[model samples]
Target: MTISIAETAETIDTPVLPTTETAKPANVKEVLAFLVSQYPLCFAQDEHIKPLKVGIFQDIAQRLGDDSQISKTQLRQALRVYTSSWRYLDATKEGVSRVDIDGQPAEVIDAQQAEHAAKLLAESKQKAAEKRKARMQEQRAKQPVKAPVAPSDKKRPNKTLVKGSKPVKAAPKAVVPAAKETIATVAPALLTLEPAMLAVGNKVLVKLGQTPMPATIQEVSLPDVTVQLGSGMVIKTRQDSLYQA
Candidate 1:
């Protein structure tokens, strides 16, 4: 029996279409494993590593696009967390959080170098302490020691003569005038010599309270004079308070 072209076409069966399985998103551990496998040189056991080139996240995203359902943004965030973990591990192992690799910044564990640096720091501190102690001792040696002051003796009161007691008459002796008395009698001559004797750097008597103490003339300005006492004390007073010694 002869069949039309349309009827013959209807008798043919339709071809079956193939189904595609959805991609699964990669977890952080899987991503880390991929990274380690892809760049074996950048990873070490119990050590940290960093990507040398920039845009590493973009490269990884593109490489994992077919197998992973994770977006580039998600992958980048995961890498950040992973990098932080590496830094923390590095700090604990090496005593430093970062290092340099192939002239690029990275993190690593280098126990030997860290220990050496610690040793050097301790030695420097010890040497500084020793120098400071020696300097303090030298300063103490240069300082002058002060002597303790002694207490002054007080004068005892004279005994009063009893009433109705006859006072003893003392024998009178002839008075002889000394050379000093004769010189003192000439006031005009003494006045001219006194001014010449009172000058800076000369020893003078400074009246303090009822007593006159020895002092050196530091300054001889008009109306006032500065003197240094024997106790190393300096004072300023009126010129009249000073006398030639």
Candidate 2:
């Protein structure tokens, strides 16, 4: 049975070597050469060394500190300077074997692991989009639907009596006649006084229609006279409208 390099790396853990007080890797190039010799399956070399995993630099720093004189911090600082000169490693764009770093093509030694990581990221994004769509549907379900309004009935004028369909005539008003004038019959004693003698404040008998009433002269003129009747009713008429009393 033949074991693949990917399967072998997963099955066996990297053993922690004892620290040996000797000349440790002095630069990033020497440090990278040591890492490649220890874990040949975890790295690839083209124009430069490229890590197969995302945190390969950190893992190398920790492992190198265990058996080397260099501190993990010093190793990390050197790794930073080295990686900065290379292009950004994007797992999304570079799935599985081939990737471009610093405009140079490199290989992924752990191709299966890189492909698995890319698939997980794609599935996560798909699930998030589905959850967003479901939430939008739930919000729409909670909204109220408006009922349509009905139009009002407008009142129209009573259809113009249907054009001479026996036009209903209005009731006639009652007619009132004008009061008539009459000659008043005076007593023989009062008949002796002449109309010229009648002055304002003089008592006289006046005829209003057919009724003879006694009144006081309020004003006197040649033809018209104003008088106040016994009932306090005032009237203005010709001097002939009066009789001596």
Candidate 3:
């Protein structure tokens, strides 16, 4: 096929830069999702998301090229969301291989990288917890105050006359209802868990690094028991690690 002079001139023209600065975050999520669909082996959603190889951004830009529908800025932003995710950080353990854009294994995550990821995950979780607690406190504060409930009336003692020169009535006294007493129950100092005796929701003290922690059973399936610690972290452990609490 013969090409016209105008066609050749048009092909030689400079390419326009992608306009992604004005792109919204929702668009970035859509872009990330598209990437996930294109490379399911490399990317995922929720807790299944995996850690990516270092400098995967350049690899993606190089592969997608200028012809790709999404802009480089949007791709970079989407990558930021993916690699910095909680699941990604959690999965970035030492000795675990980081996957390339095609899901092929690349470099193994090192000790420093794993530790850094762990620290980030912890800080993120702590921030989330603080936000939730703050919201709960704000909600409680907004709630209307309830009126105080009056104490229920009780029967007065039978009147008895005092012996004197003449009949004298006993002195009248004010009577107020006593407050209800709540008895505190302490857990057993040391009690081992038996398969037959343990059930879901049972409170147990599990030693973590030589320190006994109070936890409540969330699930019970034979040898493994899932417990929620006082700090609200849930973990699975064997029956031997638990004691009555």
**Per-model CA lDDT versus the true structure:** 0.54, 0.56, 0.73
Clashes of 3: 0
The candidate that wins on lDDT is 3
How much is the lDDT of residue 228 in candidate 3? Answer: 97
lDDT-better candidate, 2 vs 3: 3
| Candidate 1 local lDDT, 141-224, one digit each (tens) | 999988988876987645556799887555687697765643333332111216665688998888898567788989878678
CA shift of 241, model 1, Å: 44
lDDT for residue 167 in candidate 3, whole number 0-100: 62
State candidate 3's TM-score.
Answer: 0.52
lDDT of 2 at 48: 38
What's the TM-score of each model vs. the native?
0.25, 0.25, 0.52
Query: For residues 1-245, could you state the per-residue lDDT of candidate 3 as single tens digits?
Result: 22222122122122222245444334545666667766788877755666798898888889878878778877876676566666677789999998898899999989999999899777777766787799899999999999999986997658655666576577778787797796656644677766665788878888787567999999988678889999999999988899877
Please give the ranking of all candidate structures by lDDT, highest first, separated by commas. Answer: 3, 2, 1
Q: After superposing candidate 1, which stretches have Cα over 4 Å from the reference?
A: 1-26, 43-45, 65-69, 86-245
Question: Model 2: per-residue lDDT, tens digit, 70-110?
Answer: 66755565444333322213232334443232223455546
